[model samples]
Target: MSISASPKSRLLITHVLDFNSIFLFKAQVSRQSLGVLRDMKAAIYPITRPTIGRKKIPFRPYNTFPSGLKAEVVTFDE
Candidate 1:
């Protein structure tokens, strides 16, 4: 399964964690769909720093996003 980001979602890409997420994400994304991020200076970062849950759970297990891509939320482009 691929992880996709969209304006409809409240979650945003903070960093890249792994290759699996990136490959799956890219696989699901089409050439036309990539225009939205590529031209917007999207970037990937890792999430292994353990910053989730607002640091409320110090002992919580955090998965690393070795390949998370960030994109701009463009409106009226459709």
Candidate 2:
């Protein structure tokens, strides 16, 4: 899909591997389409859990990925 296309036009990424806490994904888009793949950095925070009223705390596992790509985390490192 073209870069100008909407988010839905993004290629499907079925596999996502957390390489030593860094997320790396493979897209359905062929290499010939984009020529070269670039690594993207992003933040992936943990889900916040409810708690008593007090100072708020940040989450962990802040990961990143390419923008405008549609992917599913089929498997990941623990």
Tell me model 2's lDDT, rounded to 2 decimals.
0.28
Summarize candidate 1's per-residue lDDT along 1-60 as a digit string, tens digits. 235442222233223543232111111233334553566443353222211211111111
For candidate 2, list the clashing residue pairs, or say none.
42-64, 44-63
Alpha-carbon shift of residue 72 in model 2 (angstroms): 6.4
Model 2 lowest lDDT segment of ten: 50-59
Candidate 2 per-residue lDDT over residues 4-77, each given as its tens digit: 43221212222254332332333343333333224222113232222222111122233433321112233311
TM-score of 1: 0.16
lDDT of each: 0.27, 0.28
